[model samples]
Target: MKIVATEGCHLIGKNGERWIDGMASWWSACHGYNHPHVREAVTAQLQRMPHVMFGGITHDPAERLASRLAEVAPDDLNHVFFSDSGSVAVEVAMKMAIGHWRRHDRPGRTRFLAFENAYHGDTTGAMSLCDPQRSMHARYSGAITQQFHVPLPRDETTETNLDRVLAEHSDSIAGVFVEPLVQGAGGMRFHDVNTLTRIRDACRRHDLLLIADEIATGFQRTGKMFAVDHTADLPSPVVPDILCLGKALTAGTMSMAVTIARSHVFDSFYSDDPGAALMHGPTFMANPL
Candidate 1:
């Protein structure tokens, strides 16, 4: 039951009744629909280039967008691995995390740890990390891998519980994926940034990569440029080894997402063997227009 829109935050249906959009079309219209600026940009791009497969080629729009994202993203997240949506971006982050350890001679550390009630995307890897209690896919248990889920603790026992979970399963954990401050789609559950810092420290201590799924918390949604900025005031700020971004990548104009990782993670794919080349990519891998 998708509604048709004729203007920003306004919709016209089959019955021709116009109404203000409160639902915002499943919450994807960040600037609403039919925004003037967005329309103008799309119009201009359409005039210049309508479409081109982003495989083994480059284009100005993608390059410029990547440059802008790099400038605004965290200090260390300079690289951008683009995808068409948030789900694929989450998959990319997971693949990078696993590949990192495999390249470093630690293939046994393949398990991932995610907070309970966390929601990254709908893909298999993303669904695996999400709490089944909140997901509709709970009935299809065998469809995805099981990930360690740490309960979101209250102020009194947050640190203690987190430490206990990490200690219990730290040996086989490859990475920890978190939603930073606010866990959107999980009832908008919010946690203190300090809790993220503590988890970050625990991951570091356990030699596990920290992956931040900031698809919903990025780009000033949390009153900061990124939720990670909120943790900067902590004794040890949490800087994830990999950052997943989407939703507002183009301010919601285009369906684009990215996974930014440290140089070492990218290095894993730099090998002579084609099998080790991260044999996964979309047809539009490097579209140019």
Candidate 2:
């Protein structure tokens, strides 16, 4: 369908047929369309600056946004890396997980343990992290790096299987990748907080990094700042070592995503040696406008 215009939460087509934007522009337009506040900010930003390279040159909006993200992010996830899309954010999280181990001299711990019926993104690296059997990217299996995909921890049997998989592949598994309470795309599946705790416990027991892909559930979509915040109710609250956020980050005003890491994860790359630094840098990483 051709969306000629959008107002509030509805889309207007060529024939002026209006339809509620139920999906929120693929779950990114959380604030609806043509919001005056958003428009004003964009207009003001445009008058001053639209886009600028984030390499060596720094800008106020990017710095302020980075600080705001750190302030609102769960736990000590204070470090942020920006990208232009959700898929790229997920890919960055994957790279961070694998690189964390490699920097610590455990290069063999390379692959990730992601859940079945989970969809991270469509990029080659992110595609492999999705459900290998059920994802639309299944046809590209041979082209992407294969990771471990297992069932969500919804029951004792599945939980046991998860434990077993982690135990058996502990040496090779760098981390656990999950969508937290709700899984999107592969299926709009929802698992309770206990299931999340089980995954967190398993990751803790095996000493593996936990990467939460909140691309679909961030910005209070799931009644929480981020889906991982539900874990705060557990006896021992848990947080992911790395968190991926996107979709509503700009409230659909523009395409933007972020991969945030905790202090320890960020510290691994903080060394005088140039090789120890995180090597990847996107061109439009922290576009001011």
TM-score for each predicted model, relative to the true structure: 0.89, 0.97
What ranges in model 2 sit over 4 Å off?
A: none
Q: Candidate 1, residues 1-289: lDDT per residue as tens digits?
A: 3555567777888677788877555455678777888888888878888778776677998888778877877666777888877888889988888888888888877788888788878878888888866665576566788888877654548767777777787667889899988888887888887678777777877778889988887877788888998877766677788998878656556667788886677788888887787655676543332
Error of 2 at 49 (Å): 1.2
- Best candidate, lDDT: 2
**TM-score top scorer:** 2
What TM-score does prediction 2 earn? 0.97
CA lDDT of each candidate? 0.78, 0.90
Task: State in Å the error of residue 252, model 2.
Answer: 0.5
Tens-place lDDT digits, model 2, residues 17-77:
9999899989999999989999999999999999888877888998899999999998899
| Cand. 1 TM to true fold | 0.89
